[model samples]
Target: MARIQTMRVDRMLSSMGYGSRSEVTRMGKAGIITLDAAEIADAARRIAVTPDLPARMKIDGEALDPLTGVVILLNKPLGMTCSHKDSGVLIYTVLPDRWRRRTPVIATVGRLDKQTSGLILLTDDGDLLHRIISPRSRVRKTYRATLARPLAGNETELFASGELMLDGDAKPLAPAELSVVSETEAIISVTEGRYHQVRRMFAAAGNHVTELHRERLGGLSIPDGMASGQWALLEADNIASIFHMDPAKQT
Candidate 1:
């Protein structure tokens, strides 16, 4: 089990996006915060942060939000841009206002274009974020693409040949798997995240991707019944699933 850490009530609240020290103190004075069934008397009081602490504490009569180091899985919706600075609807707006002010700041593991949607991860754990996106990880990303035209009949062999190079790319792509779902649709999995990679790959193979949605990253897939614009915090098991290898898809 992970070690249970401790921190001052004010620091914890501030870092977790509850509020600043003064605001938290004000909230405590107003009887809006409690720990172990008692009102907090001091913001500076240090308390053990246990896994069950959120349940043991209440803020405004509701359970405290999850502690920091959170990993979130969001089912992204179409027309929502992932970039924070770019114009148009942004996915971050889907989260709480406090989430936008978190100390470490939750960030996307990798980007999905506005036109594409499906399982996407955001995390405050920087190391975990880097490990998942790092080249050495070779974490597989699977996408379901709708093509503008039918397959050319040789894309499977071409993509699997490990010699396919995208336009303006300097290196050959790593081996990829293609499972055709229909004449104009297929499931493609790749170990790399290059610029417009999935679409570019199809284009390079003489096809155009009309639509795209990421279905899986490694062993983790979008939760069933999860609708677009919906998201939830990922538990340890869910996070671990990201690195699990499937015997069937070794890449």
Candidate 2:
């Protein structure tokens, strides 16, 4: 029931990080915001700051918080949708209940096409999410891709020299590393995460990717024994390593 006085409900909820201003306003006007037994009819209702405002606040009978954040990782499995719809199975539905109850809301840092499977970070910390995902940060991610062709001498050098195209786009990507793991499999590392980047990059090189699995992010990797569809709480040290900083220095 946390509450803050404001001229508009959208403004208040947006400031609290629930979502964009327009989204909150739409919810408010739809009779989603309520107090006691009465629906909050106006999107611009003035009120005093009170914890009770958000306390037990339910949209479609689901409690929500306007000012909290969450950070967690999910080993996304293929064939599952990443959306919030209830029809098809989603990544969040597979998470243990204990990890689902966090303040504000957490969204996948980036995206993995429904066919792709691997470590996906979900967080509500906007700054941290942006820092780790932004191309400007040069955060590298490694992937093991099963391809249709074997990469040899010149192929690896070409990949590392940024000499590949992305579909119709003429711009070459930043330098990436490619190591042939098998006749039809390779490990690739790239810092620029364009849409369908890995799959398209391989396709551009006269190969097709049959499967793409992310193994590392920001120089940190998932530990052994962490099964697919399982998640674990990240430690403070884990966050520090992404920046190459010791936790002690951060404090």
Q: How many residue pairs clash in each candidate?
A: 0, 8
Clashing pairs for model 1 are none
Say which candidate scores most in lDDT. 1
Which stretches of candidate 1 lie above 4 Å from their native place? 1-4, 247-251
Per-residue lDDT over 63-138 for candidate 2, one digit per residue giving the tens place of the 0 to 100 score: 5453344467777788766666646677777754433443345667787778888878877688888888887778
Once fitted onto the true fold, the runs of candidate 2 whose alpha carbons sit more than 4 angstroms away are 1-67, 85-87, 96-103, 245-251
Winning model by TM-score: 1
> CA lDDT of 59 in candidate 1?
89
Estimate the Cα RMSD of every predicted model relative to the unseen true structure.
1.9, 8.0
TM-score of each model, paired residue for residue = 0.94, 0.66
